[model samples]
Structures are given as C-alpha cells and as structure tokens.
Target: MLNKKAGMIAAVALSTSLLVTACSTQTGTESQASSPSETSKPAKQETLRILSGVVGGKTPEENALFEKEVERLTGIKVTIEKPAADYDKKLYAAIAAGEKYDLIYMGKGNMDVLVEQGALTQLNDKIKASKVLSDPKVIPTKEWDMITYNGGKIYSVFNKSEGGTLPTVRQDWMDKLKLQQPKTLDDFYQTLKAFKEKDPDGNGKDDTYGLSTAGLYDIQGFMSAAGVKYKYVMDANGKRSIPYATDAAVPIYEWFAKLYKEGILDPNFATNDSGKMRELFLTNRVGMVTYWDAWVGLFNNMKKTDDPKFVAKAIPGAVGPDGKVMLRRGDPSVWGIPVNAEHVDTAMKFLEFWQSDKGNILSTLGIEGTDYTVKDGKYSLTPDGISHGMDHGAPFPNNTNFKNPIGTLPGALEGRQIIFDNNATIENSTKDWPNAEKIVTNYAFQAMMGKMPAADAVKKMRDELKAVNLID
Candidate 1:
C-alpha cells in the first residue's frame, strides 16, 4: 500500500510541473505577439512641487485649465502648495525639515534670510546656461543686477513693477463741483475743502468726505510737498538729521491736523486699511484717494454697476510748497529655488518657459478669442473676459516678475508714466532705516488726530529713535 501511494504522489507532482511550464510558455508567446511598440514607450513626465504665498487660494479644479495649459507648453506638471496662514512660518519649517520644493516665491527680506542660511541655491550658472534666461532682451541687465547678491551670486529672480502710487480723484465729482484737478498743495487743500463742504456725490445727505486715507495717511506725499526728505533731512548746517526732527515735517503735520480737524480727512482714517478706503471710494463716500494705478480699473468696473457715469482719474501727486513732488519706487516679488530641490534643472526650465514670449502671452493675455481679441495691433477684452478674466487663474508672468508689457489696463500705463516723469524729486532713502516707517506712521497719526501736538510728536519720535539707538 505504501509503494502504491508514493508512485501516485510522484505522478501528480510531474503533472503539476508540466502544467506550470505550459502556462509560462503560452504567456511569453502571447506577450511577444501582441503590440511590442506600446510596451516600449517612454516614462511619465516629471512633476515639480512649488511653495508660494501667492497661489491666491485656488483649488485643484479651479486651477485645472491653467495647469493643463502649463503642462502642455512646458512638458512639466506642477503642484503648488499655499499655506492657509502663517506662510513664512510654514515655509521656514519645511526648509528646516529638509523637505524639497522645486521653487519658492518669497519677498526680498525673506530671501536674504534663506540665502544667509544656505537654504537657497545660487543660480548664476543655471541662469546663464539657459537659452531663455541668458537673453538680454528677455531678462534685462538692470533686472539681473537687481537680483544678484552681494557675493555676486544670482539667487533669485526679481519681479519688476511700475512703482509708486498715484493720487486719484473722482473726475465726475470734480466736474459737478466745477473744480479743476489739484496740482499744488494749496490747490489740493482747497479741493478737499470743497469736496467736504459741497456734496460732491450729490446725494444731498452731507455724507461725502474730501479725502480718505488709511494707515499712514500718505504722509510721504505730504512730506514731499514740504521738501522733507524721508529717513534723514539736511539741516541748515548741511548735516543729516532724522526727518521727524526737521522743520519741514512740522508744516506737513500741521496741514494734516487742519484737514482732520476740518472734517476734510476721513474720521476713520486711523483704522481704515486699503480695502476699506477702496470701499469708501466705490460707495461714493470719499472724493479723493491715493492708491496704486491698477486700482483705477477696479474702481471703474465696480462703480459702473450702479453709476455708469462714474469716472475716476489718476492725477499726479500734489506738488509740495517747495515745488518738489517725489514718488518712491516699489519693490517687486521674487522667485527662488531651494538648495534641496529634487529637480533644480526642471525648476530652471519652468522659469525659462515662463519668460518666453509664448508663455508671457498665455499668462498675460489668456486664450485670444476667448479672453481678448486683437485688431490692428490693438487688444480688446471680450465681454466674458472683461467680466471674469482679471483673476481667472491665467498665467501672470509679469505678476510673478517675468518681464512683459502685457496685462496693463487702459490708461494705467500712461498714468504710471506720467507719475514717473513728475515724481523726479521724490526721495526714498528713508526706506533703509529699520522701523522708520512705523515711527513715522505712528507720529503722523497722533499729530493728525490732535491727540499730540505736531512739535511734541516730532520730539517724542526723535527721542524714541534715540532711545533705540536708531538716531543720533
């Protein structure tokens, strides 16, 4: 019985081995016969992970069209991570943990910190090697110099901006009140007074104000009128002194006090931010404001819904009593690659593509027929584009610092040019002083509100600066 059982087991084992061999042979033959070309295709495309603060909180679905377009153009997939809050903290945390991000969008100050910590890679060689970045026409020499570090290493890309804010007024209101555009400080004051005393909006409720200022009340413009240099002013002896301690600042503050006391200035100026000030102008509560030139489009479009007759004009900053009108240059946003980036070459390639002409057109203009149309070299926005194109996740190479003369609104470029031409006398040296803006803003608010006398405020400001060893 045992011998019979052993023979049966041997036969079953042999049968199983033969069946396995037959199945393997058949599978191999089928695979070889079926399409070999499909099996020999290339690997999947590379994906780049970028961390940025300016993702504008777009969800995956909302960003689908942009993502698809970018991928189609660059042959690279992109994943953007935008922190809901505490962006800087989260960004630093990720860097500290050695987590890799192909690209990062950060301010100059933060970039400096990251560079100092060796968290960012120097891109001088990478930028030079790239065909797109090496072109002087694509990336200007001046912009390249701007991004170059003190050690002569290019660590980031600079976003160029048409700097300075323009003081804009309601042209329709000025027409109704029979007032010309204000050019001089006296003219500005009188215009504000008229706007306050007279109903510029014609609501007959005495609800409108002459001027609405948020935060610093735009004292920089006012100080320019007095020929006061920011940060430091030259004394009678030709020695530099803090601006707060200068004689020119006194008149400026006194003027602010007068405006505040006379109700020509918005009473809620202390707490109002840029958004609230914009709301005030759009709601027809204020006749004049100092803001970015781009806001003109926003104001016009918003007001057109209710009052098609509403027109806002960007006017030159008021000339000071000393005949000087200064405008400060604005700093642009920057993009940097981290040292631990898994795909540095891919990241560089993405930036090169972004600066390319095709990329610039796509980012700034969107799909031509769908968003805008060009006739005789003039670009006109489609109705749907005008309504929704402003923030529709379109690529904004210029917005992110890739240089292109696209995406500017009608009259905005001209207005910016006018401001640049007239603001030759503006000084921006005070920007280097740490906490100088905060000191000026605080003292200006106190002096304007009559909470502290202008002279006393200046004395207190100088004293505080001296205490902190910021001033002599």
Candidate 2:
C-alpha cells in the first residue's frame, strides 16, 4: 500500500482529471458466478450503475477502453453517471425518487445525509464476507474509522487523508538573494522583507511581493510560528474556547497588519483564492507560498516551459516564538453503496477487485512495462509513462488503492516529512462545524486589511460562535 499521504495526492490528481476517455457502447453480457472459484466459468452478466461527480470530462474512446478492461477482469459491466451540474441536488433527488445505484461517490457530509435518510447500505456484513475487501491492509485504520458510524455500521469507505500543507519557497530566488530558509518568526519577517525589496526575480521590476496567500487558512503556519491556535483551545479551567477570540491571535493579526502595511503581502490577498495565489507564484510575482506538497510537480512542469531554471523548495514551517511548529490535517473524501441497488454482491466484488494488486496496477500505472518498469523492487516510469501514466492512468472513481511509486520530487518528500514531524497539535474539532471556517476567514481578512481592529474582530467572532453554541 502507498503511504496514506502520498495516496491522497495521487487520488486528488485522478479526481481532478477523472476518467477522461469516451463512454463505451460495448455491453457485457456475461453473468457473475457464485464465487471466485466459479469466476473462470461464465455465469449471468450484470451491469452496475455508479453515480459520481464530474471533475473533468473524458472522451468516448477512453471510457470504452476502461469499461472493457474492467469487464474483462471482473466479469461485470459498469456505467458511470456524472451530472452535468447541480450534482448534490440531483444526487439526493434521484435517491428520493427511488432511483437505484450500485455505488455513489460523495463527500462525508452528503454521505451522512443519505445515511440518515436510509438511502445507503450497511457494509459490515458484506465487507466481512468479501475475500479481497475484507483485508484491512488496503484502507488505513483512521480512514476506516471515519466511515464507520452508528455503533460500527460501515456506510462508506474513504480515500486516504491528504495530510497538511507546508511552507514552500523559491530556492532559486533565495540563492539570488543570498538568503537562507527562515528558522524563526523574526527570520521569516526579514526573509519576506528581502524578497520584497531585493527583486529576487531579477527582472529589475518592482512587481513582486514576498508572499501570496488566499485567506486566514493560508496563514496557519504563521499562527503556528506565533505559538497560537485558531480553531479551539483549552482554557485555564479546562473549558473549550475559540482560540481566535483570545489574545494569542493578537500577535498573528499584528504581524499580518505589518505585512500588509509594509507591502510585503499581496494587496489583493483579501480576495485572492488558491488559483490566484498559484498564478502569482507561477507567473513569478511572488517568492514564497504555503500549499500542498503535491503542487511541486505542477509548478515544476509549468516552469519547465516558461523558466527552466525556476526551482521550488519546501521547508518545514518557520519556528514560532515558542520554538514549536503546528499544523492542521485535512478530512478524507469517501464513497459508499446505495441500499436499494440490485447487485450488492457484484458491487462489493468490484470494490474488492479495485483494491487487488492487479486492479491497483491497472488503475495507477496503466499497462505494466509500457507505462512503467520494475527493477530491484522499485518502480520507474518510462518516457511514455511520464506523459500518460502519471496523468492518464485508469480512473478509480470511488477508491484509490495504488501506491504512487513514481512519487514526487525530493523537496516535496522532505516537506511532507517535516509536516508529519511538526503536526503534533491538530485542531480538528472544527472539522464538522458549519460556518466556523468561513467566519474565521472573514474576520481574519478584515483584521489583516484594517477594515476592523483585531480586538473588535475577535469579539465579533466570539459572539458569532456563541450564537451557534460552539462556545459559551
């Protein structure tokens, strides 16, 4: 099995591109046998319908090839339904109208809604009886625990957790400026100042900023550096309190204000999203960013065309005033089966096949030797594999079972290790809290931009939390 964090990165890559091959018209007529013992002999053919989200569109030819391969291996034909738009509404409406599906790919929140409505099946018995699916090795214990609810009834299975973002900087720019990676909060400030004033891009233009960030969430590293927590914290009396409302956040906001006032931070950061931030970095308008470690591949690929010398390096988040680094983890994405599906057994078998070694190879590496080669117990991609296998492997719609043997660049791997080492305090209590994240982002932006005083903003945030009964 791939490391959980690395598996998540590949899963996201696949989810964004989805299965882009064209839809297949060829139908399988063969039926399923009673067990794997009877798999060699032909039985009745069954077609399983799956509902999924549309991330990227695929060509008809590609879809046909994938469908054919799956049918050849599992003796089951599959149909994937992706709504053109309004996916959540359509998904629930279909279930409410009694439409049946073998599998459904959804967020955990949506899965919860379906489970409450009794639209999803309990997979405990089916999973236990499954030959391939019963193996706990395929899915991580933490992820399996996430999907198991209502006293151990399994309603869904999720992709691996993507882990946390780490602070990354332009190594080429740092080399140009003769600067080292920042170690402490003060060092970080000085580095950003140098990035702003020194024109690290070497274009002799005053168009660069020290940092490009979207919202308060992007500054989780800063909060860590300041020895402050944002989501929640334990009070002196042992009661839970919103950390954003406390004095600990004051230093963080003050630093943000300084960055904005000094022009080291992007002026439009109040409105910038991740795409905009990436645009800034890719276009050479910024020197540093905090993002998922997986993006190093994307940045490197894009820079190769524009500026081959451009290099990004990942560093563990800057050490805080208290000499500790903290980061938050991301939630897992999940998939489940419908209660009213016609072929429950067949659906479980498909899942089993998906997690099997052969299935993992097909989905992750495409055809072996053509897309990749294994030597000395290690896998290396061929030139063709680099173009197709990394970006165009078989799409595993609901599950990601393959280890990303190709892996990411060394800097990314190092950054991933740094995050693992430093992410000792995870503020995951707000994972399921509605509007908590948005409230924090809005208020933090206001404070950073000077639209409101930091103290006032904190008070208002506390009031909002009280209204929601999240804090007393």
Candidate 3:
C-alpha cells in the first residue's frame, strides 16, 4: 500500500511541474512577442498635498472648480485643506508630526519657527533655475529677503507686497456728512463721532459705529498714533524698546478707552473677527474700518447693488503726534515646501506656473466667461466672478510678465503709499512671539475697558517684560 501511494504522489508532482513549466513558457513567449513601444505607458501624474488657511470653511465642492482648472493648467493634482481655525497651530503640529505636505501657505511668524527647525526645504537653487521665478520683476529682492534664511538661502517665497490694515471710510458717508478728510488723530476721532451720531447711510437709524475693526489689535494705525509701539519702539538712536513699557502707550490706551466707553468703537469688538466685521460694514453698521486694501474693490463691487453711492476709499493714515503714521507693510503671503515632501519637483513647477501670465490670468481673473468677460479686449469681472474669491494661491500676485487686466483697484494705490511710507515693523524679536503678544493684549484690553489706569497698565507690562527677560 505504501509503495502504491508513493508512486501516485510522484506521478502528481510530475504533472504539476509540467503544468507550471508549460504556463511559464507560454507567458515568456507572449512577453518576448510584445515590443517596448507597443506596451509603453504614460508617466503617472504627480499629486501635491497643500495646507492653506485662505480656503478655510470652504466646502470641497465649492473649491473643486478652481482646483480642477489649476490641475488642468499645471498637469499636477493638488489637494488643499484647512484643518483648523488656528491654522498656525495646525501647521505646527503637522511639522512636529512629520506630516508630508508638499506646499504650505504660512505667515512670517510661523515661517520663522519652521525655518529655525530645518523643517522647510532649501528653495533658492530651484527658484533660481526656474525661468520666471525669482526674476527681479517677478518678486523684488527685498521682498524675497522676507523669506530668506541663513542670510542668503531661500526657503520660501512671498506672493504679494502686502499693504496693511488701512483706514477705509465710506465715501458717501463723508460726502453726506460734508466732512473734510481727517489729517490728524483727533480729526479722525471727530470724524468717527460724527459717523456714529449722524446717519451717514441716511436710513434715519442710529445703528452705526465710528470704527469697526476686525479686532482691537487690527486697529493698528490708531494704536501707533500717540507714538505707541505696536511692537518694538525704535528710537532715533536705533535703540529698541518695548512699547508696553513706554509712556507713549498710555495715550493709546486712553484713546481706545474713549472709543470703547463712549460706544464709538464696535460694540462686539471682543468677539468680532474679520468675518463679523465684514458683515457689520456690509449691513450698514460701520462707518469706518482699517482693513486690507485688497478688499476695496470687492466690497465696493458687492455693495453697488444696495447703495450706488457706496464709494469706499482708503485715506492716508491719520498722522500721529510724533509726525508718524505707523501701518503694516503689504502682507508677505509666504508659501513654502517641506523637506522630503512628495512631488517636490512638481510642486516647484506648479509655483512657477502660478507666476506665469496664463496662470496669473486664471488665478487673478478666474474662468474667462464664468468669473470675467473679455469684451473688445477689455476684461471685466462678472458679479459671480467677483464673489468667487478664486486666487488658486497667488491672490495678490506681482508678476512682472503679467499685466493684470483688472489694473489697480480703488484705494489700492493710497494703501500702497501709506503702508510703504509708514511700515511699522511689528516685534517678533522675542524668542516667544505669542507670549509677548498675549502679555500686551491682556493689558491693552484692561486699559481699553477702563478696568485699570493706562499708566498702571504700562507699569505692569514693563514689570512683566522685565520678569520674563523680554526687556532690559
């Protein structure tokens, strides 16, 4: 029986071996018959993962059209997401956790930290190699320096030369009130008083505030009026002092106290972020505000339906007592690539494409018929296009090769001058920026709400800074 079983097993093994060999021979023959050209496949398209704060709260479907257009133009797929309201914190966690994001849209504050930790890729070599990128016309050397690290290495690039929170008032309001352009801080206050008391909207409703900033901190120009340091106080001798420690800050607190207690400022100043502020202004609740100049066109364009006379213009910053009007320079809308990120080459290519005229047109103007129309060679934004907010990444692009058909929007020029002339550099000099800001913000709120004397607040701020070794 054992001998019979062994003979049967041998026969089965031989059959299996023969079958396997026959299959292999057939496959080999088929493979040999096929030519490289006949079987060649196209390269797999690369996909980039992006994290940006700009598209916050946007539905995937809402973002899909613009993203699809960008993908079609660049031949690279991109996935963008805003994971949290505190974008910087989210980004910090991502970097800490070694998440592989191909592109990161960040601010200088967080960029500094990422650069310090060697989390960002060195982009200088790549930028220089690209045809249109890093061209003096594309982005000036000074602007590039904002993202340059280790003195000369480029780790990031800023999209636009940002003009900061500007004093934008309703042109109709000024005309209706018959008020002159406010040239000084006190003059501005008086204008605010009139705006609150008089119905500039002419609705016969006392529903307007003198000023409606996104936040108290965003009232940056006014904060600097009394020679207060919104950040670092630089003297004629090139000495850096803490703004909170100085007597100049007392008047700033007092002025805000007046605005707050007297109901000249927004009632919801504590809770009103940029979004709420926008609603307040659009609904005819705010007479004046300090916001990004870029919104002048969009806001005016949007409000044209309700109020034809809703002409909003950004005025020169109200001159301060120290013969200065400190405002923020244009935002450094900086973008970066992470070290060892997937599709690095593709990411770089996409960035270069973004700065190109075609890409610029797409991002700046949106889909030709959808976002804008070209009638007789003149490009005008359609209402839907205007509201689309389609800036694939370069919302405020400054490409020399691309002459934007949309030209300069209203209040943009004055905003540029006001910012460039009075660029008050905010202090990020401390090892911990958030801590410094927190210390100042807390004291400022107390002073503004009349919970403490401005002098006492300043003294406390100075003492705190000293205790934390933030000041000498």
Candidate 4:
C-alpha cells in the first residue's frame, strides 16, 4: 500500500536525523585561533550542536537570524535539530549510538537515567564558577536546588517553570448575567449558579453550563481555592503521602458534588478533553475553565473574528473558606550536556549567554523587526508574532533579572504576582506511584458525580492505592 511505503520512508528519515559522525573532528564543535602577534591571541571560534526534543516554530531564515544573534553575542555557533516524534526513545538511542551533542533538551524524568549512566556532564562546579550561571537572578537557588540530587551534585540546568494558571472566564457572560467577579469560594459558587439559571448566553434554549474542564483535576484552581492539594506531600521523616486520599480533599469533592447536583457543572466535564473544553468555552456553552494566563490573548485571537464582542480575561484566584488563596506551578524544562561532548567550555559560554538579559528577550519576544517593532518608545507585536506564539527555548526564562520589552500575554505579569502573593506550590510532575493517578481520577469523578459519598470515595481511593502498594 502507498500509505505503508510512506510510513517506512518517514521512519527512515527520522532515524537518519539522529545520526552523527562520532569522530572528534566531526563532533560539530570546532575552535579556531586568531593571529597571535606581540599584542595577544584572541582565540576560539566555538561551534556547538544541540539535539533538542522540544520542537520549535521558525522559518529557516528566522531561526538563522536568531542563531546569528546568539553567535554574535556569545562568539559561539549553535545548531539545533528536533525530531517531530518519539523524542525520549530517539534521545536515548542517539546517546547510545555515541552521538556527541554538546547540549541536549530533555525532561526531568530523563535526569536520573542519564545521571545513572554517567551520560551527562556534572554542572555543580561549572555553575559555581561561572558569573552568569552562579547569579541568583539568572537562576534562583530554589530552582537550582530542584535539579540538585545525589548528595548535592547538579548535572543539569532547567529553564524557567511555566507560571501557575490564572484561569479565564467569560467576562461577557458574567456582565450579561449581572454577576460580579467572584473573590471567595462561596462567591464563585453563587456566580456559577447564576450562569446556570440566568441564561447568560442569551439563547432561549437551556444549553449552557457554568464551568467545564478536560478532567476533574483540570479545575484545580477551584480546588486550590477550596484548600486542596492534589500532589503527594513529603514529611520530615521522609514518608510520602497523597493529599487526594486525605481529609483535606473531602470538601473539594463535596463542593463539586454540590455543583453537579445543581446542574452548574457540565455533565461531560469528566469525559471532555482539552479540545472539547475549549470548544465549549468558545461556543458559549461554558462560562469558566481552568487555563493558563496566555489564553486571554489566544482566546481572543481565535474567536474575535467571528464574534466581535468576544472577551475572555484571566481573574484572580478565589479565596478559600480557610481565607487563603493558592496556585500551583509545574517544574521547569531541563537541559544538559553529555559527558563526552566536545568544546565543554564553549557550550557553557553559550548557555550562560542564554541566561543574559538580551538572550532572554530574543528567545521570548521573537525578532525585533519581524515579530515586533518599537517606535517613539511604544512597543507592539506584529500579527506574525502572535501567530508564531511564544514557542522558544525559554518562553518563561529562569532569569529573574530578565524583563520582556514587548510585554506579555494579558494578565501574565499579574498572574506571576498572584503566584508570588499567594501560597503557591509546584507539583513534582516526575513522581508517580504506578496506577495511583488513574485510581485518583476514577474515585474523584465518581465522587463529584454524586454516585458515591465523599467519604466513601476517599476510602475506595485509598484501598485501590494500597492494593497497588502505592500507599500503606
């Protein structure tokens, strides 16, 4: 069949992309010395190759210009390539095949394995010695500590973690329904009830819900508002406990059960994927959904042409009954060099340059002339820039000193402040206790749907986790 043949060809192409000449001369890094006279020899035209799993969007010219900028600023030639699929397997395979990449883009999950195999170059001394790398502004001590393990040995550096979600809601609907923005958990409950009852979408048919998300956990902003922590917690004794199976989570389930009973929460929420959730939000079927801060601009970008009055805005998190507001962020993106990588000094220089102010702006804001332009001290983004999106090596840079000259998506700054102001936490995405997550989701859905009592659901969840030896 034509399809089968095409598949094989595609497979061959993917495999070919991973190939690299293992010889020292072909290591993709080379340095040439300048003329040395009585004055001095300024040496090294360092070239570094990066094998990345994080896919990016840039035309050949666009990327070339960025690469040019990087080299011009840091005196290093950088090249990057990413396969469109099967990244984790291909990355390990390439390393196994002796691919001498100067830098590798990987996730936190890959760190332990790479460290165990002695595949990554140790960064503890490198970080401590370098001016740019050692600065707390370039990377906070907390973030560096996250990557430090095996008796305080740091092997990798992480880009900035994505900010906590400041979920957007239908401001138009809230205005139409004569509802004020919700501040407290109770206020949120009432607002959702009004959205259900008042025909916020203004259609005669009763086809709207107050809020929806891809999964029960996707509505975690509200759960956080109700003072629930979903991730496992560690005690001083080094014992781990999942909060989802504890008393603290009971009220959150009960709250959702109330919403379900009142017909405020969407029935399909349990089954809906992210695409489905966004479709419902865009088409005016749901008034609220948990999403990132960037969705404010993105939702408008996607829906505004059809509906001129479409307005989506991120709001501050609701205060819980415990009188506390909280939000959770995720771990940062990790990158490291292989132990056998050539031009180690050059590679470190490039990375340090990336952590600088200028490099941070270039990565996040796109090119000056094309993605955006400034005139008379006023800056604005081009249409092409919005289309390109913030897809880059460090969309959220770890550098605390870096500021976006082009600004950011709506509510981004405020969202960062909210995280800073509130009792925020970052869930460890790497840790999982086998079937624990599936078990939690199952019991959570049932509890919110009112099929089982909250107490019973927690007990069942604990039992399931126990059966798998995830918890004792």
Top candidate by lDDT: 4
Task: Give a tens-digit lDDT track for model 2, residues 68-127.
Answer: 667777777877676656566666676766677877767655666677777798988877
Candidate 1 scores a C-alpha RMSD against the true structure in Å of 15.9
Model 1: colliding residue pairs: 159-401, 225-320, 326-426, 363-395
**Looking at model 3, which ten-residue stretch has the lowest summed lDDT?**
1-10
Candidate 2 off by > 4 Å: 1-43, 54-69, 83-99, 109-119, 134-136, 226-241, 320-322, 362-410, 424-432, 468-470
lDDT (10s digit) by residue, model 1, range 5-100? 000011111111110111112222236567754443335566777776653224444345555666678878776666666666666667766677
lDDT of 3 by residue, 1-472 (tens): 0000000011111111110111112222226777655544445666777787663213555466656767778867667766546566567766766677888877666677777778899888898898778688887666776666666888876644565667788888898899999878788889999999988877888888988875554666776676554555556785556765678778878887898898888877766777788777777888888777666766776777677778888776667776777775543666789995877887888788777787778766776666789999898887766665544445567675677787755555665566667854533343354556667777777887788998999888878877886565
Ranking by lDDT: 4, 3, 2, 1
lDDT of 3: 0.69
TM-score for candidate 4, residues paired by index:
0.80
Query: Which residue ranges in model 4 land beyond 4 Å of their true spot?
Result: 1-45, 53-55, 58-75, 85-100, 107-119, 300-308, 316-318, 368-370, 373-380, 429-431
Candidate 2 structure, TM-score to reference:
0.76
Candidate 1 vs candidate 2: the lDDT winner is 2
Q: How close is each model in CA RMSD to the real structure? A: 15.9, 7.6, 14.2, 6.8
Q: Where does candidate 4 clash, by residue pair? A: none
lDDT of 4 by residue, 1-472 (tens): 0000000011122343442322223233333553333233345457878876552336666766766666667767677666655676667777766777888877655665677677899988998899988988778877776678768998887655556665578888878777888987788898888878888878887888888877753566777665766656677786667777876788878888999998999898899877788899999898888766555656776676688677787776677667887776544457798998887887788778778886676667666777777899776778877766654556668888877776665545555666667776655433353356778889989999999999899999988787877665
Taking all chains together, each candidate's TM-score versus the true structure is 0.78, 0.76, 0.84, 0.80
Highest TM-score, which number?
3
